[model samples]
Target chain A: MKDKSIKMLKTIGLGFTEPLIRLFSGEEPAKNGKLFFKQALLPLLSIFLFIAIWYAGATALYNSEAEVRIEKARAEQGEEAALAMRKCIESGDVSCQPNTLPSPAQVYTAFKALWQDHLSISEKKADFKARVADTNSEREAQGLAPITYTGRPSFLDQIGTSLKTVAAGFLLAVFIAVPIGIVIGLSASLRTSFNWLIQIFKPVSPVVWLLLVFMIVKTVITDPSIDKSFIISSISVGLCAMWATLINTSMGVSTVDKDYINVAKVLKLSIGQNIFKIVLPASLPLIFTGLRITVSVAWMVLIAIELLAQSPGLGSFVWEEFQNGANDSNAKIIVAMFVIGIIGFLLDRIMLSVQNMMSFNKGIA
Target chain B: MAILELNNVSKSFGAGSSRIDVLTDINLSVREGEFLAIVGFSGSGKTTLINLINGLIFPDAGEVLLKGEPIAGPGPDRGVIFQNYSLLPWLSVYSNVKLAVDQVFPKMSSSEKEAHVLSYIEMVNLTPAKDKKPSELSGGMRQRVSVARALAMNPEILLMDEPLSALDALTRGSLQEEIIKIWSRDRKTAILITNDVDEGILMADRIIPMTPGPKATLGPEFKVPFERPRDVTNINKDAQYKRLRNDILEYLIEVGATRRQVSDQKYILPDLKPTMPGRVIFGRKKKKDKVKYF
Candidate 1:
């Protein structure tokens, strides 16, 4: 039972827990202690060190920017004006404050503010929903459109939108690339002919893809009810990120062990069975590898695409915060940056775990 | 009547200057219920021969016939136990055998198919590990799964392409006996390709030695006079077994040496050195003045 749990943990990319589990099960304590220190505690220490460095850097930047502002005031005006500028800056006036980089404490405060904002928005949404419930019912009875909430999205809502968009874009990439990859992979001639096309399109910028999608979607999708930015951004992300999966799938398909093919032939399996049973299973490891790359690529390009499309996602949130120029705007932007990074890391881990599950060979993952 | 025949079958690979004959002018016939062993050195076109019979690859000249009908392509009628144990790694032992059983016996009921798969798994002593994937199985266990998969197809002619070569000696011997036992039940026409002369002598009704290639061909056939249920332990003491083994081995070594002699085309490389020989030392020689060396 314990072994099974260990295997499960290892499959989920949590092999660091193996030593902990062993120690708890009364295995060698000293050995497990060393392993735990190396695996878990060391990484925790590094994280703390990273925050310390960031805090130091942020403080240094703030001090230098403040000095520059005081110096500028002294040069432009008299000594009295410079003294007043220093006093204003010391009093935490938003107008004269150095807002170049936000400290770690400021970022935490910003995170708390966003959380509070989200809570307030949720309460407002609930109040609005309750107020409109009777009218919405009456409208539904009369076959008329219902009232809806049209307020600005909160930080959490923006994150939710980003997640939804990425999911849709990833699905689009899989749907577009996998079958095409299979077909191209099966035929050497097709692979050779399409190689130029793939090479040309694989490295296209997400902004260009968004513009291309925007051009087509604007003309084709005339419905105002549909979110045009969402569609445009997702399509762009899909187009920009699908190349990894496409290439990997084809390579995997083309390089399936010849012996397996021979077995399929001897069995007299039909084309469909040959592909699903023999070909797909054999190339699944490679396909999963491609998918993992696709997911990461999709995520990396999504922010740029979302920003260009004007979708209310983390990208838009970051851009808006940058332009807001509020006292805590830099801190909020830093928070968004960390959220994006942590989410990207989590997305990659999820892909890896899924890949490990699909693979029969434990060593493949 | 012969169940399977390779009539003047010749196969080659590549074209133009790169073209080389893998097998040429090969002919053989196996009667129903006969166990035939084609023994040869490694890379002696033995796999090519088995592939031709199984219809995995076509012969460049001549035809492979099954029951007087020329074989067009591979089918379940000729089941091949591949050299590398081509059991699908993603599939468990049961599922691997079930895949062939499902294809060959599609009309069979689900329960019947399950029974068939399980029976073969039992036959190869892999019933306990039936739920385990090929990656989890050892080399011998994997080969057993391969055997079970091929047998589950119930092919009229069984083709084995050095199936036991990858296994240890003990596993190989036990598998040989198990195969013979299985073959005797329905008396299937089995063709075993192997490099072991003793294996050929122990398992086959007729043993045929293939000479070494670029254009490898079959030599004279030697008949194994041993009876059914031949014991590997006691067979060593038999004078007949020793003579047959020696004869086949001697013939293989002789043909192999002669082929090597004829095919030898040594090239004389040009005697050349670097432009700055004193400065550039090659092949583990350190220069006196400089520290760097190749």
Candidate 2:
């Protein structure tokens, strides 16, 4: 009994005194203290609560407006018209119905069905290729266009194409912009001479660039005959993305500390070493910011180009769905809108993660 | 033999109406392994003289020779420590020193170069903050890294331009001691541009005073007879140190007074505000009134 009491007393002593010991030792306390509350938990909790409030408020507003629209349509169309619309919907002729807006449940169902269709087609294609390889006659007769997967490419395939285009354009922009920007940043005379041209081109709309690019590709790139559509679209998107990197790089170089330049001079650092070691690293954070903005702009322009040019991309998929106006057309359009939004968000997040990694020396603040 | 020589060096700015002479027919020679300090008032062309030595700018007349050969441009052999701590802000202390060592000793192995830089950094007692950037280090620590960088180059002459004037008195004294210690080890030819008379007396083998400009020139060179490894605390007790310090202070005071008198005389409004109003302000004013018949 005495040993048990001693153990209990020690446990209670630690529960109370451990926090004080940790605080004095500069270790974070186990329980939340003023420092912990200010530094870690409070800000995180506040952000969480803010997001929750925003989601709830937006959902409520959407639901109320949707209900009002349904009621008004039913009242105006009369019971007979509503019955005809119900029959048309049951028969899968949704375009014949008066109301075009589908409920959220219908949209979700359509999205799942499309996803399943895409997966099934991909599986079918893979199985067909395997079977053809096993059979000598089938492989010899089929050629490039196999019969097993005869349907049009799915929405996911189109999205993949769109993403590839954006990647190619963004990479090309980076390659072209960095060297020129560094040169312009380093030399005052070059900057003055080139600045006017950059200013004139930066604000020119992507549509204008697209038209110009279309003409150039048609007239100049004649040998072997490139895909004019893809070339024009990618070039337009890349041009739109170029401005941000160039402007940001120049600004970054121009803002490098004067004392560092003096140090470079006194050390007699070579031109290449001075640029790569001193100027480039110093201007990294700003240049990365510019790169992020350029990527987002490229993504936006790529979609528009695909739609206008009838290129195989996510934008083309959306346009095709809108034109179809089938039973699942409205639902498919809503799903595509959400997918676009999510993809854009993911792209931005990736850029942010890369920026954070590059600037690790400068703490998160 | 003189390690460095300046012969009737002069510099001027602008041309025609805007032309102004900064330095005029100045001659000086720095002996081998000697520490020389040039002291002057603000805007007295001391910086211009140092720039000539460093080859950052050229003298309009005459030449500057390093070991009987003229300086073409800034080279690794003449390392300069600027008044402002010029450590590259993006570089850590170790890299800043290593950059110099790597350039000068390019044939050395990587490990050897690293060891060489770290030794100099440790010499300045900055080993603890070797990986910290200039922005993270204190002002004094940044200056210490600059010193380490210059020293790691192993230059024949170390040109310091008031390197400690920006630091607090205590930091300045500590750095001054560190510099003396470093100099005592190798005894490289050094020329310091400073305004502090005591700083000159404490560190230099000779203190040369510079007069003020539109046409500045070296006034006189005072030899310091104090022994090496001199203690700052006991420096005042040395009779020779005291006498040299007093002489430099006296000369500086005379230059200061002369400059003030010249300034006052130059800005004096001529009696051209006609004592007899419409007396025709013609080609030139009469010298009789300006002469002041006292």
Candidate 3:
């Protein structure tokens, strides 16, 4: 028995020591590392390849259309037609000109110009601050006017606003939905009575809800006490986002294992204690999954809300730029698209990290 | 004094036309510090019997007296160890045991409570796995955690429902030894519901064979007068142990055969194909199948 105890201690000691040694010494990567990379490589490569193909196709279409229009102009209207086309192209109104898509080179030039302007704005802001101490009157007269030279909201500002709206809507949904869901789930009669209402409301279109919310915000909140646009847009997003969490929480609580309930009964646990210790822990995995789905849905829906409500978010920025027909608009659109994608990905990763921390056993694959 | 008494206990489910009786006219008494094993085939009301004792389920017509008082509902006085090792998978072995200890010993100092829980965990030989969650622990280890959790509560009675049935034979044997050692030390009133005849014979001071449902009832109660701290290896050497074991086995065999015969009668067998010239039959033939002089 003594030798067995010693052996057990040695094994446990090795378990702790091995990881530390690997970390400090930086040995060859573990076998699982190769498997992890193998699993991830295909998806990463496919995404990159798809984007490359799309860029190539768009470039080809634009170049061929431009070539056709130039040839037609040279043949029918003489050398003057060529000059007129060049002016239109320089003016960045390629769509107004007949049959010609803007070349990829034009798009790249527009993107670089916008990027340089954004850098200049930051520099200007810094210079303005330094000059303000010396010549306050002149700077006050010049007063910053929403940095309109860029012709579109910078990629960072749009992403930040979109994220803010999503965060607010998600928090509001969590506050209202989870407790109500739990109550409904715990009582069979209540669940039966309320299920019809949930079913009816859950499948309703977010656009219809958005329109209704806009009307309500317009008529009822007359004092202009808040940004009515933000309020309407958030409520719209929340309306769509709330259902997933509500359904998930209800299912999670309802499916809590009978054995745990029996244990609670045998222990004579108080109602509050049972809810906190047993029911909540057992339901966490499901609840987290629901929250994840809800957050994603809210994010996707928030853009639609922004576009409709003209809310100052990534969605509205993308919409306005698309309508304005500016030279740099397409670049801004691409930037906005990538920003939304990355933010959504990050949100999921954050949730995953939190879920991992909350779980007691690391055995869940 | 009788720690528990069941008088004319009967349980039934549903009502009117759909109503079906599960147990009827059951009578039994358990004295303080007695270890009793209830044995039966599948579908027997043995689990229902334990549930009734634990107050998880109510009897349709009966009185279940615990310490001379009728049980009202599930309470900490009767801690139950479930067959599935229902230790909350989210909690570690130590935490699971500690949870019970904390509830039952609300006034104890934190250290005292910790020590109490740890002692029970040690008794079950799960001290090394104390920090491991149910999902991380082996089946035998998880069951040990359940046992520790129940024992840590220090209840007057421990109700177990086939607690070791899911374990492999070797693990079952080891756990049985551990449980016996713990029972000997505390002498708490314990009622174990199991389908294993050998398990009932090995652990209990008395083994009560139960028949199957509907209206299942105790068939016979066999007394085991083996010496204290009986080892499984040497248990067969005792004449009384052998006699008691054989007796219980005989009752189980008879009950099992009767149940099988009733089920077999319900099944419609397909017409048999003609036997091949080279095929040989096995097992004892029916009396009517005697050939030639036989």
Candidate 4:
């Protein structure tokens, strides 16, 4: 049981706990504990210390900003205005905006508030959906087409939109890059031919690609009902992210162990079988590395594309909140930042698991 | 009739002034059920000759024939065991063998293919390691998997390119015996390429040495007169073993420097002072500037 736990920990990259598991499994505990302290405890302590410093810095900034606000109020309106300002700032009233860096407590509260906001907004959406259904049923009874709900999307809706766009974009990138990469990988001449294009376009920034894709999308897509920005942003993400996968896939394909290629040939495997069985499998680890990078690049570029396109996503949400510059806007932006980070981390973890499954080389993370 | 034949085969690499003649005028044939060994030093293009037979690379100037049909490309009929084992590291020993079995005997039932794979694995004494990947096995064990992969294909010919050369002496000895047992049982036409002279004499009916090269070619073939069920240890005491090995070694040494030297311009060579004649002693000089006043 302990051995299995050790393996699982190694697979998930919790190498610190492996020693602990070994210790529990009847190994010497002192040495294991020392190792655990080195690997796990030190890092944890460092993180806590970092947070402490952040908190201290926030407190100092808040005190200074609060003093500045009080001084401003006194200069503008006298002691009464200054007292009111102090009370509002000190009591943390909803009306006044604090000019200080957000404390850890404030960030935590902001996170909770955003989550609650999402839940309430989802409840409202459900209520609106039900009302639309009822009204649509009445309208149908009167021999008319059912009316659709035109409600504004909530913050949660925006998050979902971003995820969907990124997914579509990532998928598009994979579809475009993998096949082209395979063809290029299979043929030296083709690789040479595509090298010029890859080299030229790969270094081009996401913004330029986004504009190019946006222009094409605008002219080609005339459908009024569809959210064109989703397609635009997604295509832009794909355009920006595809270079990583393409470069990696081609490299992986080119460098697949020559011995495997010989074995395939000696087996007299057909071209398709040779490619699918030998080429793809042998190059899978590197290809997956590329894909993981591609997904990350896609996610990073998505915010910019969505913001520029005014697409319904977390990118637009953050942009909108920044423009609002209300008392809660800074906290909300911080909320979106953490959300984006967590999502990116989760995506990478997902890719790593898939990579682990496909790769034959083990015992190295 | 010859099961495998190479006629006036020549091959080279690179182009223009950088062109290197790797093999030249290689002519040989393997009769049905015959075992032939080509022995040579490294860079002698012995591998290039074997690859030509296996149809992995085409000869620039001549034809390769399998059963009187011209060889076009690599085929299932020619199974090659490379010097480095060439077993797919990603696959288990069983799957590595099964891949060949599946491709060569496509009409065989799944159970039959499984049995075939297992039998060859058994032949190589690797049945215990059947489920293990090549990386999990030791060097000798990995070579056994390569042998099994080639054997499972049941090709008309087995082409080994120094298959046992990578293993240690003890492992190489055991594997050599196993290879002979498999060869004798099936009696398929086989070609073994190696630098080991004793290995050639012990395992093959005929031994041929390749001249050292920029353009390497085969020396005269030497026939082995050893009886069946030859033991490697016992063969050392035999007069015939000594004669054949000495004769091949002598020929290889004689012609080792006969091939035309490759020009230094072909390579990006480091700057070094040209040695003055009679200034450098040739043998076992630890560093440069050794001179003998004989």
Collision pairs in model 2? none
Candidate 1 lDDT score at position A156: 96
The residue-by-residue lDDT of candidate 2 on B68-177, one tens digit each, is 99989877788888888777666788988998887789899999998899899999999999999777877789889988988999999999999999899999999999
Q: Which pairs of residues collide in candidate 1?
A: none
Residue B268 in candidate 2, Cα distance off native in Å: 13
Q: For all the predictions, what are the DockQ values?
A: 0.63, 0.23, 0.48, 0.46
In model 3, residue pairs whose N, Cα or C atoms come closer than 3 Å (at least 3 residues apart or on different chains), thus clashing, are none
DockQ of 4: 0.46
Model 2, span A1-365: residue lDDT tens? 53454344333332333334446666655553665555456678997896567556555664565455446557998777656655654565635533355556667898998899899889877887677664646655766443355568888888888888888788888988888899899999999999999999999998888888888887888865466677778878888898999999998898887767766766688999989888998788878888989889998888778888787888888888889877788779878878888888778877866665455246211
Considering the two chains of model 3, state its CAPRI-style docking category.
acceptable
TM-score of chain A of each: 0.97, 0.73, 0.75, 0.88
TM-scores for every predicted model: 0.95, 0.75, 0.83, 0.87
What does the lDDT read for residue A153 in candidate 3?
52
Q: Give, for candidate 4 chain A, the lowest lDDT window spanning 10 residues.
A: A356-365
**How accurate locally, in lDDT, is each candidate?**
0.90, 0.82, 0.81, 0.86
Cα deviation at B282, candidate 3, in Å, is 37
How many steric overlaps are in each model, in order?
A: 0, 0, 0, 0
Candidate 3 residue-wise lDDT, A1-365, digit = tens: 53454344333332223333343455555743453344455567887897677778777776676667777788999889967776775575846443324334545665576567667766766666665554565555688332223334554556677888888889888888899888887888999999999999998887888998888889988886478888888888888899988998888899998999999999999989998999889888878878888898899898888998888888897798789776567766766676678788878767765665565545632
Model 4 C-alpha lDDT per residue in residues B1-294, reported as the tens digit of each score:
788788998999899989989998989888999899999999888888888888888889988888889998998888889988877767788888888888988999999888888888999998888998776788888888888888877888999999988789999999999999998997998999999998999899999888887788888999998888888778998887788778888898778744444334456679999977786677755777868773
RMSD in order of candidates: 3.4, 12.5, 9.9, 7.2
TM-score of chain B of each: 0.92, 0.88, 0.86, 0.87
Arrange candidates by DockQ, descending. Answer: 1, 3, 4, 2
